[model samples]
Target: MSHGYPKEGFNLVGSWDDWKSFVPLSRSGQSGSFVARVPIRRPPGLEEFQILQGQDWAARYYPTARGEGVEGPGNAHGRNFRVTPLPSDCMQLEILWDVLGRKVTWKFLNAAEQEIQAGEKKVAAKKGAKARSAPRNQASNRGPFFLVGSWDNWKGFAEFLPFGDSFRTKVKVGLDMKRVEFQVVVARDWNRRFHPTSSGDGLAGPDVGHGLNWRAEVGGKKWLEVTWSPDRAPYVEWTFPDPADAHEAAAEDFAAMLRDLAKEGSGAWFRGMAGIFEALPKCQRSSPYGAKAENEATARCLLATFLRDLETMADPRGPAPGGQRGALKELEEQCEQLLKDTVGEIDYATAGGDFMQEALPVDPATGPVQLKLWHRLVYLPLVMYVRNTVHLYEMLERLKAQSSGAGRGRLRALLDAKGTARESPYSWLVFSIVGALQILYHARAAAEKRGGCDAFPLELLASSPPQTVWIQDGVEWSPSHGSGAGAFQRKQVVNCEPMKPLGTLRKGDGLMYRGIWLPADADEDTIRYQYSFQSFSRSIEGVMRVLRFYSGVASTKAGEAARAGHILMYIGVKFQGWRLAMASWQ
Candidate 1:
């Protein structure tokens, strides 16, 4: 509506001119109304138009509410006005401005001067009587509106009944449907349908059919309450069935039971995986320690047996009793064949070199090669388990990232560790226990392959024994041993009961222990084993250096050639002649 703009400024912009040209509106004499006459040749069903002031969009007249013949924005905003012209040869449109609202109230008339459609109806009330609203049950003058959508395969329609100046109807809607697209139409005609102005609500853009249908999410509701009126656009609301209806209640109960069962099944699968990881080490230990020679005859077959058992336990059917399952039996057989055909004929160092170089079987070029007992059973199985475990951890990290609300908080609490431990201790324990089994298997296999001479002492492989020390009043008796360890525990404090690693145990000690050590004043050492890969790597490197030098020296002896060979194989490297240098010893 033009507030104070000149009447000559108002012009009609419509689809008849492709909305590119504005047709000037002439001022009606003395009525202060602006009018535009549609020529007899201009045929119309529904015509889109807008009234602009001074031919500028910034001053265009938009309808704040839909009136009788004009369809304004319904459930949408910033939409052009649309109206259906009567079948008459010519029609005239008159507009009155609402200055405060900056909108237009319009009416169209046929040549007979009879009103066709009015934007709003003005009611006259008696002077001494109470004002009354228009009749609610009266149907629209145009035609009955019908509701159509995927609910009925888009074949049929549900007629809307007038209710308090608006049309409404109830239709059955399934909660499981992913999309429920529908529209309001007059007499069930596609040519006279209503659609949402916003395209993002599961609707296509202007290039599609007549327009995009209105979409509803349904969202676990049995019935949808659809409504349409002049003032507001067509929209839907959820309408649940009566709670006392036994059939409806039974359906809801069944759905809830299904949800609970699904949750239980998922939980069981996760717990089963955790149990499998926990049992892997114990299963390896239960196999006779070094009796593979008598049963399998070769280290290769013995290692294959271990791999078969490991994969069998992870099968969905359940943990295998002890040996091979059908899942990976063929792969296990191939590993045995490959090792037996290649091990003694080729350089054994090549097998060890490949295994160490590709700790993971990620390189496609070398992944299928299994030439030694270590490669087939020890390294391959360990790497496979580690890789799969990493995948599971990655999935858990993604779940943690996407999780929100109470569920996210609970998941975070379950996955995260408290205090200094950044991650769950159980996760670390799985890796440590699995690595230990592989180490033991490798040692036993290597020794057997070298005729039982290529064996290293347990003390050489393990960490330094924790030395006993004492503390009083938060002061250590032997700080010189170095308290660089990650943690410690107090066995006894003079007359006090034994305490956990707390306050003084962490502050007073200077030496990091391989395990819990007893106080110097205690009756005996209370060893608590705790080890890591970093410690083992350092220890093994030193032992290899010493064994290499000794092997070189022993090679010169009269009948010690076999002993020297075993020594070289055990350390997995050759002595490049000892050099006298400060860095070499360090």
Candidate 2:
């Protein structure tokens, strides 16, 4: 609902506050509506509150005369709006303000579970049926049922306590959990597991048919109730917090991660980037066209901006007085040197060697042959690339003690060669870089600005030939890219082209590549950098190709047979391997 007529905002003053220290409501991203989720910490009972404009009792909101039992003059001193308690931890307070008459209207809603049930009711009504509740029957399990899911890394078996005709267990979810998938197993047996019958909610029955994993949106919930009995549907009662609150919770968790990293050993790198990290997750916004493309472009530019900024901050010649070396100068130099050593002096023209030369024949008339840096980068052994990257991170940690600006803020390397500790598929370098870029991108979006120049504040660094640099469309040659010398200036990248959908599938598809003009401000002509943006696009295209293959060659019955045959063949291979291994042991 609304706030102070047309002036600033308003707060919800109630019995909980003793009519003092009013709770302010935030704008709900709507025109004239404001909302707040007021926590009910005490006993559930009648809650009395009134809309107080700017925390002033002189301009309080009361029940409208149109409301039943609302009597007398609906003025500042009128009766307070009343609400009976419902089964909820918090109450949703919505206020609508009308500037014309300085009128105020509000309503209370049971926040979490009730909101979900209300939606369920609407869905059931549309299907011309009444909403159904989980059936309760007294039945004993053959053995103890164990809970296994993401909450416990799918390894530990948390046994359920016996309940009336069913086994029930309390799942305490982590604060960072966005979604959770789980299953109940009897006697800790994987084969005797329960799954969702249809692909929606969970069902428990004899393992005779295929089923999907039982899943639910945790949405920042701290606890869940999972109940199941034999020959019945398994039920998981999930407590989903308010969506806005959930978003805030997730953002706080991500910020905590960044703060922890800052405290570890790369303090200089994260020095003035705290505010940016805190605002990154909130940068997501809905657009007319889906947000996927927007997210991708933002992600790409963000990565570019982060790498550029890191290079600038770690430059040997710092912007600080006396031309002092940067705090990360040593780390930067070591990493750059390591990269150069690993890849060697890359000559893009001759990097591809015989294979690339034969693939793309160059005419003698066309001066210098153009080549893609991407090809060279990808062609290099992935193991070598990752190994070198890991080495760079290790060097950063080792040199942190001698580094200046701030210490104990080093980003940890995720790729641990010694498998003593757990590690993620993505390395810590990727995480740190991605986090920094997100901050810059969101900060730029909030400022309502476009273009790489505005999005990234750091002066574009200078790059010599034989070094790889990404250039987007709409680039124009300028005297200098940044303030420094030997820098080639070019027009800033504002927008990226939307990703196109894969057309009709073919038996085989090659790399769909394109050529880009590499800016050379000094010379009138610029060499083209050939690359493929469709590398990632091929994954989805491959899936579509398989689907089209089946659709073209087989009928529904035959398609099902083919799928079954594939599964049987896969199982047979596994069995054969097991037999061979056993024979080898003998």
Candidate 3:
């Protein structure tokens, strides 16, 4: 038999597990004709069957009275086609189906091709079928579909209103429910359920089982829109554009924002850091390195506590804390030993000038003086702190830059009010120290090239052996070795370009030397100790400004002298009267 639409296929569904155990009819070489042969059996009598278009029950051929050639209010009650009982002797039967104009007809024949019975039925015209049959841009006649899920215990379906080529529904999900899962069903039938694939496109399959349910957060006021092409084979999309109950003001929102930023080349490290920040209690959200004064004060107290903890770990006189020692505890012990032994009895005032002028001594016999264990202990935590802090700062700056109007106002307020440094002291210190280390390492490397010591500081000092780290769509480099040496090594960790500072000979655009990421924009002082010294100077100035602000010192020369006095006392440096003249008051 032939159909009006030749490309459309039909399935044979009947009373015996009709939905599950169905047969597909084969199209005849003659245009739209379709044919299928069946072998009759006893026990469960085969009395009724429906010719469904592909897997869609909504587009089935409903059997009608002989001459009623159209589907409407007249033939709305037509059920599945009934079959006449076959003779006891007969076993095989062949069926033929065809549609002509508005009428559909089917007939059964014996093996000899003799017609046993014949029936003629009218095809149901879709609602407003005439308009639908017009030009491509005309209004469509496809009826609405329904949604079914755990909401109604899967017993009944909910209707979706048509809008252009899509269908939409406003579902009332319980406010207390964590999530809602459902699927689109056509014609309230089990055989025509649209289950989503991994890619979110809908496909007709068996019962829409658990885990196969299209899931969405239910505690929010959400609008679900499903788009489909009427003339095409089954392809459907379900999207939720806005969720009214989204927790934008919560920590999870910031975490999600960080995750998104990490999708860009330079942001992968933010993923793990974001988790740590998200887990922090709201009261502890502020970092000492933060921009706002109040948060910074809280951070300072926290830092003091952290330092005290370190001192306890360092003191051989005291027992270490119980439980498995973490990275911080291990580091504290290393720093404690280094402080007590390696640089013992040295005054910062006397040593500061030498450390600043002589770049640590490297013996010609050994490559470079192995960095003290304290450097390793201090390095990792400082790296983590600097990375997390800088990431937070960059995120806020980008948000403030991108937002406008009321959004911009709110972000601007957050930018100004948050305890994040506009020029991060923690980041500056981290950069400066790491830069100084890099310079010392490279100097030793250069000297080794000229028949000097072959030892490298980073290689000797790094906690883990050098390994290449990869960034998605970005350059790669080793963290424990200087740039050119490990550019081709295979082992990789993070997924972002290694930091490459401006005016450097490095091939990449980011740095992760010695397990610490250095900002690409900061100037590195490889020759004249200008950048590191300037960074240290600025940091001291920042501390002085903070002291003056807290002390309520009015802008004056005496107030400046007091702030200078605080710094000179802390660093154990002599206050040269002429140098004090150069200090700027806030």
Candidate 4:
């Protein structure tokens, strides 16, 4: 039927047994005209049948004015067109429905013309039919089924290749055809066939009505492979592994792990714990010694609460025992309370002493021993707290990336709020703990130094070497003296070269001028500079080699001076605004 509604199409419906279902009319080759040829069988003594314009009774058509041979008065609800049984066995009735005018017209063709059209249809069907061969692997007792579709010109069925657990076939669809429709039939038996859903797209379940065909739109590529899996419901899927299905499966597995952890501790709990560790940033897990006791406990509690809420909210049975909105809020309240309780229990005075005794059993009778014990206790947990906070930050970031939908809105919001590197509560906690530990370490070190025994040598506290070092070329003269007035005074001409700008540096490397330490500006540089005096033996030997070349100094005396750790002082020369300096041994 032609419809003025323009947006939606309508189907034909009637009271006859054969017309109970909707039959769509063709609009091809006609302007605003919907045409259909309905074949009706009249049983003996059958008087009349009713025909309507739409699938629903509400949309049924009614006559606006009475016409010749038309029966019945129309009403607001609906009106049925009257049908008269012809004397022949069956008749082909042609109908034209105009939706805009709310009118329908129909007429029966002469018996002679109907017979001629029926004969022509049969001839065309015979010409289009072609016998298709069965697959080589087909069972002898069972006949072969084949795939038939518009893509193949409706000529005949094509055989499918037998493969492990499935049947497959490749077909080429024409680029010009915007869409193609097809079905699978068993040994030319239409009744035993696979059809698409009513919309002629997607795989149809067994519960779907019959006679519909599957359809696919043409892609840029011409070649397509189709597969059928008897074991799988709907029996068909396109392309390769479905990305939506894969993503859904991963989400399900994550949810299942959370559920297991919430319900009880078992193998599933261990697996879930592994997932927590896996979610941590790689850098956090790199340390040989793992997390501190208190931080680890906090992390476990946070994870447990977070997972419990996620599982409860996502439960299929609906949020009941644990309401969606309250679950996370309750957990957050509990965590805040726990933080308060734990912080109250910290006794700073006894905490440091207790930690020192627990970390190291050695008696702090000596200054050095007390200092050693304090350093261990303070540094160990400081490292661990930093790592745990980092792990927690990374876990939150991962959850934020994966979260979606209204159900997870609160969680996403919380993650976004706490995701900052600078003001996050976890970061603040780590910073406060580390600062406290450093204060404790320094206080204990100062106390030990006040005692009679030497705590640690201050002379050992020299800056580390610069990463990149260069040897000097030009020789400069310098005066050197040590241990006595005017003793072994000499004018030393040492090699010098301009220092290169700093880049990436490694251990055992430094900037040098005439084989001596050249300190880069310490005020502006973040990297500590190492003095050559720290490696006394090597520095003296290097200077001695230069002295031997310039002066006739005895090898024995130079070796003695190197072993004694006494080196001649070098002076700086302002060359091209760069600090060029060197050391010499007397």
Best by TM-score: 2
Model 4, residue 193: C-alpha shift (Å): 39
lDDT (tens digit, per residue) of candidate 1 on 126-245: 111101122223222233466788877887566654333355555666658866877666544465555444533321111223545666676676556565553222233323343235
Question: Which residue runs of candidate 3 sit more than 4 Å off their true CA positions?
Answer: 1-144, 198-210, 222-586
Q: Each candidate's TM vs. the true structure?
A: 0.18, 0.25, 0.19, 0.18
Give the total clashing residue pairs for model 3.
20
Which stretches of candidate 2 lie above 4 Å from their native place?
Answer: 1-7, 11-33, 36-82, 87-91, 99-104, 107-232, 235-325, 329-586
Runs of candidate 1 with Cα error greater than 4 angstroms are: 1-142, 201-211, 232-586
Model 1 — which ten-residue stretch has the worst lDDT? 523-532
Q: Using alpha carbons, what is the TM-score of model 1?
A: 0.18
lDDT of 3 by residue, 66-122 (tens): 635434212232466665554322223444556443434455543233455433222
Best by lDDT: 1
Q: Quick one: ranking by lDDT, best first?
A: 1, 3, 2, 4
Clashing pairs in 4: 463-530, 464-530, 467-505, 476-494
Query: Candidate 1: how many backbone clashes?
Result: 5
Q: After superposition, how far is residue 45 of candidate 1 from its true place, in Å?
A: 15
Q: How far does residue 131 in candidate 1 sit from its true spot (Å)?
A: 31
lDDT of 1 at 582: 13
How close to the true structure is residue 498 of candidate 4, measured as C-alpha lDDT? 17
